[model samples]
Target: MKYKTFALSALALAASSAALAQSSTGSVTLYGVADANVQVLDGASSLTRVQSGGLNGSRFGLRGTEDLGSGLRAFFVLESGINLDNGSNGQNSFWGRQAYVGLATPYGKVSLGRQYGSLYNLSSDFSQFSNNSFGASTAVIGGFGGYEPVRGGDGSAATNGGPTRINNSIKFESQNYSGFSAGALWGAGEVAGDTKGNRVADIYGRYTQGGFDAMLSYVDDKANTVGLKTRTVSGAASYSFGPYKVNGGVISVNDRSIANADGEGYWLGGSYALGQHTFKTQYVESKNKGGLVDGKTQAFGVGYQYDLSKRTALYSSLTQFKNDGNGYVARAASSLPANLTSASDRDVTEFVAGIRHSF
Candidate 1:
């Protein structure tokens, strides 16, 4: 799939709707995903708990589209992230995840608002875990601490492939041509006294044919505090044969906030589906190179998923992360509380079982 504005693409909008309304002039859709899991953490602290958003973040959303004649359409989306375990807003905003409107034309589409970064759109399809906070893309490419540039003292408030979403942004996507598509976006920081002090920008392209899929992405973030800038370049690909599928990608980061904040990582994973069951496995490696930051990390995971129906599944996985240097803190990729210790050389391990449903 091509990376495009979520609100501008009818298919992207429909992916989150729980229901659909068909009309001559327009259509409306309501959609969401509910996923939760039982987790066991065994590191510095050992505990078990029930957590939300195992395979996907629980969410509810409404999307609408109206034809405007002459091969044009007006579309909008309002998506809310939710916490099923506590019945609270996932990110403290009613429309914390997405709220955007755009126009679609025969040539391409343009949109503005809060939306996903094009890099994620391109790399996610090639990830074994679909960039879930689980064993694949998110934990590897977009994880926590200094690997990601810190903003407002929060390590998670940074971007590797553009922070998953951008606020106050404008996006454009070209129509697919012979299975190839390209996209770009510019996110204005809206800083009070500084015009370009805090800004975010990215460009991405994708190609698909037969059983092969590939993508390349580039993003620059100057959205953090003064003098902090980070640039990321990433690419991924996937192929399928019979019931087996394989995927992998590499991500490089140049953190200009401080000398030697540069880092890089890569992952390889595969899965085989048989009947209603699928088996999956993956390996990820990260390095803090140059500058002052220095460390190496490795992660491995294995999982199984059993389909109970078209919209629901039972899944379980075991994952572990090992750190080799004092400053390389990330040890695992799981939403479950079970995780690694910040102490250098301490490894984190976890086991999880979950259910996911979508409508």
Candidate 2:
């Protein structure tokens, strides 16, 4: 009887040890975001859209990490975009926005799959909208410019492909060093028999210390549709003093295929918080060089938000855009337009008011 009891105890101990080992080795997490809004566009005519992912892109994702031990980890992320309005899949892909597997260690992380470029991440980090919001001017100022035509064969704006995201990418992010971090990404063109010239590369670095922050980025793409290689460089800084934060940045783009096609731009933005109310404003300008015509444009916007609860808020924004030179016009691609000239000339003004909730 004593021998049987001892053997049973030993078996239990072994099982417990195996369970602990498995638990220490890996974990998986499920996370998601949902955002929707009813919006109106004015300018040339009145139009309305029930939009999903207003404040944030709606998405659901699974993320996992396995400890390889010795401070090294194997990780993966598979995220799918979702349309909250109709409870449908966004982009109709299982892992549309982000699908990557990589390794992480004290050195940093190396990931391979569809992902954003380093320049995109750096600019987004410093922008007030961070590539969201109806008032975001990143696309208008040519800061995020690329070769993909805005309109398709039907002359309507194309949705499937654009500059905002990238595919077939391998990226590396360096571990933070003294409050500074850097990253680089390369997108494979995957063209058979030719690999060198048909790709994109981007690099970015940033420093943050105390209440001050700064960033810089550069991107180059040769496979763009116009057969023109494009290069962009941008930098910005921000400071926080008490209840207010002020930030600004400058961006420049060069297009080799289009004559007079170089462009430079700058932005200044700030926000102030007072009790339950926050006020924000920004101004942006861009100038084109050696293009068909010297194009120039400017934009100004202001916004306010009131917190209703920890997870809910009410917000409103007013913005306007002005353009000059031949073929220069501003169009409200994201929100309601404000004036008739903008409607006829492709210029735009917009206002947005909405409520947002998060969990």
Candidate 3:
């Protein structure tokens, strides 16, 4: 397999910013992705738009590691999202995407800061679409479909599909043993008066051997805003044979109180690579099992990618959202397909052609 990554050194930036300890044993690197696309979004009306991140999100980040002592290292990362279409920041926070520092030992690694929840990390691998705004089920399942920019923000609890990134969190992951490993996280509730305010946590275990991979995950969300409690459990798997690879997963969100609704979603996707070109297809469907929420969203997408080089690629995809059942809008977690139409049951179509470069 051949892939590309773009990374810059931090020595230059460090030279001007701070004095480096002559004895310090560590290094820093800067890296990011630049991706942009043109799309036709057909919502209530037809709209043409230029977008960023079709296959992958664009963002720049700084990461560093320092040798602390015998078999120990201190590490940190500061990452931000980018929107090339408008030249705007991706995440709301300056380093909204990720800002964390941790220690790595022979046995495991532990860190504290804003970080990805267990479920999100687990889903990224098994997911064929990976919650892409356009081609992924994660978009509709977790409300990532542009309708909510802050799906995991404070005050919003248990309403999301996949357990998203967490803020003010502590996490631990055991060193990989063979082809299996485990990890857990605890996001602290920062409210002074309330101990459990905005607190969340998750745990997951994964195994991979040869071309087969699988995972089991659990999420516990306890938000103080409305005292809403959300619990989730999921299982997923994937396999690859020759030029073809297949992936699938099932997720269930248990939130039967406030909204009196429990959400469930399933997705399956497959791809085949022939030389420099790869073809893709996927389907995602989600619904709330109870409460007044009586709508579900189903999406189907197909795309092609042509490798321009090891560092860049040109790609295109066409996706449709069937806002069937009740009155669900055609949307993704990060980007909406077209826009929502006046009729809740209307279908939305999306097509994108784009170029992506990594550095």
Candidate 4:
């Protein structure tokens, strides 16, 4: 969305509100997902625990819109992330998931405030696991030490995309023209004296036709640290036929924080749905091409789901992770204890069973 600001006089505002009260239309909706799971981890250490967000994050949100005439609408969203396991803020801030206000025009949408990056939003269309944190999720395989660039120590820039959200940003999204749409976002650095430090820019294009969907994304982030920058390029696609679906994607990264550091990640997966039962499997890999970051990992995952109703389901997944290099230390699961570590050449096995409901 494109961001625009306007100033209104008190008399004008009062007159508009009075007119809106008489003729304007608007609506508000409350929605959320409640998802949790029991997990077992087997590697250098064994542990069992309950976790939040197996298939989806646990959260609640409010969204509303007002008709502003002329095919234009004003809208706002306030979404908060939750940790069901402990009842704590999932993102450490209220409305951490999304908080934005924007205007929707005939041509496109423009929004301002904290929002998601285009790449992050596009991944859902092509992710077999719906971009969740379980199974063979891309989130697990692509951990080249913070592939998702967040605000640095100086704290000037918003985080860049790895399917992660960005703060202090403005976004513009084009209306779908036939089967294609495009979007771009820019986050100002707001540095004290520097114009370029801690800034992020992202852009993406997508297409959908019949049962096929494809997308490409690019991101550039100037970290708060001096002389460091990160860039990412990604492409993904998915197709569906009958009750079956297939998905695959690749991401390449060049992070200058570590000299010569370059890496790539890829995944291919498919799913079949029949009646109330669905089955899926995926293989994912990440490799480092340069620098001392020997981040190489491979994983295979399989899962099953049984829908109990339109808004609830029972699901389970089994995955195995192989760390191929000394510098690659990610494990097989998400939200694990801080001390959990995977040694090079060691395999980490994970099992998860969960339930998810949405409103």
Q: Which candidate is the best by lDDT?
A: 4
TM-score of 4: 0.87
User: Candidate 2 has what TM-score?
Assistant: 0.83
lDDT string for model 1 (1-359, tens) is 35566446877568546234336579889999999888777777777777778777889999999988899999999999887878888655678777889999998999998778765565467767766656534455553222342221122223211346777779998899999999888878777886366777878998998889999988887855545677888888999989999998888878767663777888899999999999999887877776665777788888899999999999898988776776655555653343435453367677889999999
lDDT scores of the candidates, listed in order = 0.73, 0.67, 0.73, 0.76
Model 4 gets an lDDT of 0.76
- Judge candidate 2 against the unseen true structure and give its global Cα lDDT, from 0 to 1: 0.67
TM-score of 1: 0.86
Clashing pairs in 3: 6-359, 139-333, 144-332, 144-333, 144-334, 145-332, 145-333
Candidate numbers sorted by TM-score from highest down? 4, 3, 1, 2
RMSD to the true structure for each prediction, in A, is: 9.8, 4.4, 8.8, 7.5
lDDT of 3 by residue, 1-359 (tens): 12222223455556645545633578889998888889877767777888888777789999999987899999999988888888777655567667899999999999988777766655577776676565654656653432321123331222222247677789999887899989998888777887565677789898988999999988777765544567888888999999999999888878734765677888899999999999988888877677665677778888899998987999988888777656444454345444455564377787888998988
C-alpha displacement of 152 in model 1, angstroms? 12
Error of 2 at 213 (Å): 1.3
lDDT of 2 by residue, 1-359 (tens): 99999999999999999989987899999877766767655555556567666556678889999999898999999988777768877645657767889999899999987776654555466666554545644445532323111110110112212134556778899999999999888877666765545566778898999999999888776654435466777788889999999888887777666453677877788889998888888887767766665767677878788888776777777777676777655433243334545434655667767666665
State which candidate, 3 or 4, has the greater TM-score. 4
Per-residue lDDT over 165-278 for candidate 4, one digit per residue giving the tens place of the 0 to 100 score: 777779999999999999998876667786457777889999999999999988887755444576878899999999999999988877767565677778899999999999
